[model samples]
Target: MSSKLRIWVTGASEGIGLGLLQHYQNLGWQTVGSSRRTQGPTVADYWIPADLSDSADQISAVNQLMTEVGWPDLVVLNAGVGHWATADESARSDAERVFALNYWAPVEITRLLAQRAEGRGLHVIVISSIAARFGQQKLATYSASKAAVALWAESVNEEWQGSAHRIQLILPGVVSTNIMRHSIGRDGQALGDRAGAHRGWSVERTVRAIERATRSGRFAHILASPGVRLALIMHDLCPSIFYLLLRRKP
Candidate 1:
């Protein structure tokens, strides 16, 4: 692994992506951060602009970068949107939008990169949520979308079994970020205030874990917080009990 490896971070304008960029920069790594709206810090050697939701634009952005900077050693698919809704309250359009960004977009980008970097040592990092481990009340759509991403990563990892490219899935528990404030709820409301109360891991802590995992070349699914790890173990040990505890109150 190169000390000054080139990295591409999607959703780099804020949240975990932004924190990761800052941390990597501090470690003297060259990075390119992408976002749909805000431009990333110019301090980065390259800032490839992109909107993951826009498939054509995202492909073009990557092509442009490859023409200029060659293929990135690591690509962090960190951009995502969360929407929570009860099964009965969820709208078709809401589910469509969530799947488009949270699942399809990353899958498309990963496919494109894998095809282009056939024999290269490429690492693709996916930022899935711990909610993916099991369905959550009022978070059906979000959880399902994350589950799709996680399963996709697992499939891709298997497909690249004898290849140099690798896929990594990161399951992060609740983090104090603007994503909570922006996440849509069952009744199309924001969960900003409510999510703040569910304390788990800090963005810095998750970012550090991501860096460590990437450096260690670990391809297995990773849980960023101990709470999530414990929850997963319990869920596996006693599914009925776990489901009962996770059931939503009416």
Candidate 2:
């Protein structure tokens, strides 16, 4: 068996996933990455190409990892898609597609890993958006899916109280990524430039925060700007006022 520390990162083709994969690689650890696209630039010692949104693919990827690479010291369930649409503009199919990748994929993957761990200690980190903390205007479906997974992680952490396995959640507000350009829109198509530009934390900074959180033994870590943090505090402590402010036309 390989003695080097190992980490598995999903959606390693880009965004925070790619950043984490590279960071660990720089540390001389064994890195395994996966993406839906079989052909793409990636940084990983091993690359498993599987569309995790599909149930069968999810199993196949996990089996491949366990059979070939043994087990990783850390598993980052970061494969996710974004959706942008108003309630009226959202279609059922699009919503399902969003949830398939953003919610069910990670939940199912974590379940399989936990079962296969067989008393082995496993550290699972779930990357959920800060948007999951509360609802948003155009992010109805996306926010709901994220919230579902975040809550699921929270529940799992509690459920695994006495076990060697643990679940950590990363709630990042906004990181510079192509997620916006690739986000699904009302017509179930990439929003492209219509989604508008977003300026937030860089992928490197967000990854550093995640690294800190994983080491901090925290159940959930919120990576957001002070402005965003204040908003979340308001949402939690003063929902009435928070929603009242949200009602204002922007």
Winner by TM-score: 2
After superposition, which runs of candidate 1 have C-alpha atoms over 4 Å from their true positions?
1-3, 186-198, 224-227, 247-250
Task: Let me know the TM-score candidate 2 reaches against the reference structure.
Answer: 0.96
Worst 10 residues of 1 by lDDT: 219-228
* Model 2, position 69: C-alpha lDDT score: 91
**Which RMSD values do the candidates have, in order?**
2.9, 1.4
Clashes of each: 0, 0
Q: At residue 161, what lDDT does model 2 achieve?
A: 93
- Stretches > 4 Å off in candidate 2: 40-42, 246-250
lDDT of 1 at 45: 68
